[model samples]
Target: MDVVLASSPVDGDVGCWDLQTGAEQMRYRSCASAPHGLASVAGRFLASSQVGNSSSGSILYWSWHKPQVEIKSFPVEPIVSLVSDPDGSFLLGGGSSGNIYIWEIGSGKLLRKWQGHYLAVSCLLFLDNSLIASGSDDGCVRVWNLVSIFGERDNERMKDPFLFSFQEHALRITDIVSGFGSSNSILISSSEDRTCKVWSLSKGKQIRLITFPCIINAIALDPGEDVFYAGGRDGKIYLAALNATCPSNGKFDEYIITCLNEHSKAVTCLEITKDGLSLVSGSDDGTVRVWDIKSQRVIRVLKLRDGPVSNILLVQLPNSTSNLERVAKLPSLDKNLDPTGTLTAIRISPLNGPPDFGYCSSRLMLNAIKELKQRSSVGAMEMELDRLREEQRVCAQLLQRRKKLFDDLWRARIDTLLDDDQ
Candidate 1:
C-alpha cells in the first residue's frame, strides 16, 4: 500500500493517509516539521526535522505502528532541510548556519560537515546515490560528490566541496527536484522570484527558464520528464512543459499548458505518484488534495485541523512482520556528534599498515574506501584478493571446529556401547 504523508509548520503531528483507500493512518506526533524536512528513511521508518519551540533544533523518528515519537536527536545547529541517501546509509542535514552535516545511519555518528552556502540551506536533494544537490536561502544551488566529501582532500578542495554552483535564482529557492538519470540528470528548482529554472547537471548550466504567474513554493517533475508541476502561492498548481517546444513569446501562458485551481490558499508542497497517474498536493488551507493527472480533477481530499502543510512524502508501506522488526531494530539517534567512548586508532591504508589515528572507526573505513578508489587498478585488485583469502581462512577454521565437535560426539557414543556390554 502506498502512503501519503503531510506536515504543517504550526502543527505538532505529521499526518499520514493511505493513498489508494484515502484512510487515515497513524499520525506521527510532536513534529513541527520544517519545509523539506520529512523523509522516509530507506522505507523503514519516518523521520522529520522539527522547527522546535526552543532555540535548538531537533530531529524526531517515528515507528510505523506507533503514533508517538520513538527517538529524538538534537543537532548542534538548527537543521531546516533533511534527507537520507537512497540506501539510507547516511542521513544528511542542511543547517540554518549554512552548514551541511552527514551522519552514518547505524552508528549515528556525524561523518563529515562543511558549510556550502552563505545563507541557510532551504532544501536538500540527493540527485543520485553519489551526488547531492543543496539549495540555499541565498539563491544558490550547489552539487557535491559524496565520495569526495568523505575523502582526504587538500585545502582548496576542502574549502569548496561543491562540484558546480548555480546562482541564477534571483531569490531564495523553496524546493528542488531531480529528473531521472545518473550523471546527466536534470534539476528543476522553484524560487521566490516567481519562476522555476531547469538545469542540466552534466552541462553545469541552465537549459530552460520558466516564468510563473505567482511565486512557486514547490516543484514536481513529470515521470516522463516532458513536463513539470509547480505549486504557486496564488493557490494554483501550474503545469509547465519541459521538453515541449513552444514559441518564445515572453508570456507566462506560452510555457504553461494548464493549471489546477481548487486550492483555497497557497499550495505548499506537491508530489506525483510513482505511476504518474495521480498528483498529490498539500496547501496552506490545511487540506491534502489528490488530483487525477489525466483528468486534471480532484479525486480525494484530506483535511487537517493543523496549520498550513509544509512537507509531503509519498512512500510504500511495508508488510506487518517487516514493519514490526524494523521498528524493534531502529536505533536511537544520538544527540552528540561524537559519542563518548575510548578512541580507537584505525588504518586508512593497506591491511595491518600504520594506523591513521584520531578518528572514528566508521569515518576511517569511509576514508579507506575513498583511498581504494584513488589507488591504481592492480593495487585495488591485490587488496580484494587478500580480503578473499582471509575470508577463506576463516571458513576453514570454522569447518575444523565443526569436525572436532562431531568426533567428540562419536567417541562418547562408543563408550556408552562398551559400558552397556560390560
Candidate 2:
C-alpha cells in the first residue's frame, strides 16, 4: 500500500502511515500550519501551503527522502489552496487576494499569475493542464482556459481565459473537487449553507443542488459517478443518488440512499482511494477512518494526534501488489459480508450483506412493524405469482391464434395448386 500521509497544521506535524501496523512515522515541524494544503507530486515529492496570512504566503516542496523542505516559493498573497499539475511540471495556488499563482516546480520561477475572482479563493483544482477550476468566498465557481490565455502572442488576441462560472451556493465555498465523470466533466462544491451543488461542465449549467440538514464539510464522488458521499458537521456521512429524482421545488427530501455514522465528531475532510473502493475520512475527533464504500462500513481507524483531524491522504506505495490482491479478494455485491470483518453480524448475507438486521434489532420498531411487515411480504409475493400466471395464459392464447393463421395460409396454397392442375 502507498504510505498514506496525513497532516495537522495545529500540531505542526506530517505523518506517514500504513494500515497494517498503526505505528506512525510522523515528522513534526514548528513553522507548518497550512490547512488542506498538502498534495503529492507524482510520488516524487510532497508539496504543502505554508502559513500565509495576507499578501505574504509561501509554498514548500519536500523530497520524499528528506524531512526538510527542499524548495520554497513565496507568492505575493497568502495561499489557501494548493495543487500540482498531473505531470508535476508546475504548481498552482489559490490565494487570499483571489489571485492564482503558477510556478514551475523544477526552478521556483513564476510561470503565470492571474486575478481569478472577487473574493478569497477557497479551493482550486486542475481540470486538465489546459483548464483549471477555482472556487471563491464570493460564492462563484470559475473555469479558466490556460490554452487561450498563454496561447495568445498579442494582448489584443488574448481574450479572458475565464471559461464558465457556476454560482448557486449562498455561502462561502469550503471545498471543491473535480475529476468525476470525465476530464472537466463534473464539479461538486461544498459550503457552509448545508448544500452541495453539482455542476456539469459539458452542459454549462447546474444539474443538481442537494440540501442537507447540516453544513456539509466534505464530499467525495464514487468512481461510477452514480452517487456521492457527503460528510457533514453533524457527524454523519450521507449517501445521495445523483440520477434519483429530487423535488422540483428543491425543498423536498431528495434521494438520500443511506447514511454512515461511523464517526462521533464532525467530519472535516474526505478522500476516495484511486480505485474508489475505499473512502478515507478525517474527523474533528483526531481519527482517520477507512471506509468500505460498497459495504458502507468502516474497515480501519487510525487515531493520529490529540487535536482535530484536519487532512488525510491515501497513497499507493511502489510495491503495492498486496493492495491489488486484497482488492481481488473482496466479495461481490451480493455477498453482504464485509471482507474487512468490521461489521461482524453472524447471519446469511442474502445478497445485500446481513439481512436488514436493523429490522429485527430494534425492540420498539420490530414490535410495531412485525405483523404488518409479515403480511405485506407474503401477500405481495402471492399477488406477483398470480399476475405472472395471467400473463402466461395470455401468451398461450396468442400462440394458438398464430397457429390458426398459419393453417389458413397452407389451405389457400393447396387450393391454388389444384386450380393449376385442372
Candidate with best lDDT: 1
- Whole-model lDDT per candidate: 0.79, 0.66
**Which residue pairs show collisions in model 2?**
2-315, 2-316, 2-317, 336-353
State each model's C-alpha RMSD to the native: 18.5, 24.5
Question: Which tens-of-lDDT digit does each residue in 290-327 have in candidate 2?
Answer: 88888888888887654677667665544422212221
Candidate 1 structure lDDT: 0.79
**Which predicted model would earn the best TM-score?**
1
lDDT, candidate 1, 1-422, per-residue tens: 79999998885678889999899987787788889999897776788888777778888888778898877888888889999988666788998988888776666667666778989999999977667999999999998876566553332237766768999999999999998874467999999999899887656678899888899999999898999999999999999998775666555667888778999999999999988999999999999999999999999999876788998999886655332344434445555545332112221233474321111254554466558868755765665665577569756855664564355446546655776799
The residue pairs found clashing in candidate 1 are: none
Off by over 4 Å in 2: 19-23, 26-33, 52-55, 152-160, 180-184, 246-252, 319-422
Candidate 1 worst ten-residue window by lDDT? 340-349
Global fold similarity of model 2 (TM-score): 0.69
The C-alpha TM-scores of every prediction are 0.79, 0.69
Name the regions of candidate 1 deviating beyond 4 angstroms: 153-157, 246-253, 323-331, 334-422
